[model samples]
Target: MNYMKNKRVTRKKEKHIKILYIIPSKTPTGPHIAILNMAIGISKNLKMKIFIITPKSFELNYKNYYEKLRESASIYEVSFKKQGILYWLSLAIKAFKLALSKHIDIIHTASLKILIPLGVICKLIPAKLILSLEGNPLYEMFEFSLFNRMIIILNWVIGMRLVDLILPCSKWLKSEMAQYPFLQDKLSFLHNPIDFERFQNAKPRGIRQEIGVPEKAPMILTVGRLHPVKDIETFLKAAEKTVKHHKNAWFVIVGDGPLRKNLENITKQLKISKHVVFTGFRHDVERFMAAADIYVMTSVYEPFGLVVAEAMAAGKPVIVTNVGGMPEIVGDAGLTVDARDVDALAEAMLKLLKDEELRRKLGEKARERIEKSFSAESVGERLVQIYGSLLKDERQ
Candidate 1:
């Protein structure tokens, strides 16, 4: 009986694949949220031992999400003053030790900043390193100074070669990275998962009453930072055209950035200021989504429109720019228009607002699509398949 019990214990331990996720962020950003959701999903769906390391302050800042995630994985908090070389080195050392102690099978991270350190550590360990590409590094490089751009390029050339797998968050990003022949062998695409429960349960927070808009007025909502890339100017212009037909329609832009003043000026110039409201940065974005009749994303370039999925999860019909991965996420559930096409955007918004039956059908389809494709369980299953293949190849 003792010998049989010992053999069963070993078999049970072998079935649990260990993965370590290093997310070096104090606040909940897009990459951080994506990692957390993926980790939770993997833990729930697979017999995996999951470990996560983040800045010590992350727990304090996002207590609710942290607690929920802790239930699914072993979370370790590490102190870091700034995201510099020393921080990355510290994270690498911590991860290396944990990987060795736990016999971690895979190490994953979304940030390029820590790629080099993690890559170096992976070379010395038995684990496979997976990099989750959340944005177009080549396109984003131009946003920085010349020296910083060079650093980013160097990181890509060196760090990418060290990674065992490169998982872009969208197929659009995978195609963009495919231009580099070296990345062809390692590249794959994975869509970001959404926290459907939160969005589905969110109660409307009476945003119309707070903003002095009529309760029954049709509300068109767009949630993203007011930046040039997001094309808020186009949204405001589209709103200008939209109000010409539906005077009772209201446009709400929820987010803040350096371009807020410029976008606000554009709203004034459009003479639709009365019909538009700019609510700078609100945490309760789900509540706003709940209150809105329609959702729109006018990004000039988007990697994977996570907010589009969020809006879809909220059961709101979306209008996304036909760029990057927005169309892929929207599929047949919502409308897609050319970026910066104010006329097309206005027409789509009008169509959704005017045809209640069409809006209802699209909204139902949007939620159904999200449940089927973008749910945590679905994403987790895809990830587990990838992990299994990678490990199987390693053994062979």
Candidate 2:
């Protein structure tokens, strides 16, 4: 009886694992939000103690998320106007000190910039370093200048080799990373989690009325920055053809970027300016998802489209480009068309718009997919299992 009682006590003592999440972004983007969501999920579903470190601007810009995060983890805010070398050095030093002071078991981050420096620091301590592959770093470097691209590549090479484990957000990303022989052993796929409750409970805020679309008009929505990689041009081209078949259909683009003016000009050229509404960046995306009859994503490259999952959680049928992880996210629940194929995109949109029964069925399946496989609790449980197995191997 005493041996059994002692075993229970030992198990109870081993339950808590100290984890520190370092987020380098000052602004709230999809990847940052995804990491924060996972942190919150880890705290809720495990006996783990969570710590988060980010720039002060992040806390200020994402007040609601900060508040939600604070309830689950301890937050350490730093000041940085720009992400220079000194800023990264300061962050690494801060993280190193905090990890030691708190006895952090694992240090996780989504930034390669953070991973390379922190990798050196983790060697001085007992903590394991984890890098979350939120996007394809190599592909993203094409947008930068030649000098900056080389610098980013150097970071990727060093960071990929230094981290103990690499968690890609999708199987497609894992396959991409596996091309590197060194990363083959460390790769694991972890899908980004959606706040199922938030999306499921979202109520329509009359976005259609505010945008001047009739109440009964079929509203097709796509949410992403107006960037070339997002392939918003293809969405517009498809919108042009889709409107020809269903003149009453409205296409709403819910983000802004460098390509806004060019995209608007294309709409004018196609004479479908009246059918497309660019709603800039919106915080009430769930509401917009609620108001939308269909959700579409046309990215030529995406690691994992969190917005697509959010839309699915909101019970909206999705149509995504057959690139990266989007087809994986949509699975059999919705349609997948070849990237840059305007006719295929238009046909998919028209099919969903024309058949209310098919849309309803797809929407139902989409929600079921999210609930069964990608909920916060499920993700948190998977994370805990990974941590446990890693630590167990270390002990053995």
**Top-scoring candidate (lDDT):** 1
lDDT value, candidate 2, whole model: 0.85
> TM-score for every candidate vs. truth?
0.93, 0.93
Model 2, residue 20: distance off in Å is 0.5
Q: What range of 10 consecutive residues in model 1 has the weakest lDDT sum?
A: 3-12
Q: Rate the local accuracy (lDDT) of all candidates.
A: 0.86, 0.85
Native-to-model Cα distance after best TM-score fit, residue 212 in candidate 1, in Å: 3.5
Predicted structure 2, TM vs. truth? 0.93
**Alpha-carbon error at 183 in model 2, in Å?**
1.1
Q: How far does residue 65 in candidate 1 sit from its true spot (Å)? A: 2.7
After TM-score superposition, the amount by which residue 269's alpha carbon in candidate 1 deviates from its true location, in angstroms, is 1.2
Q: For candidate 2, give the lDDT of residue 134.
A: 82
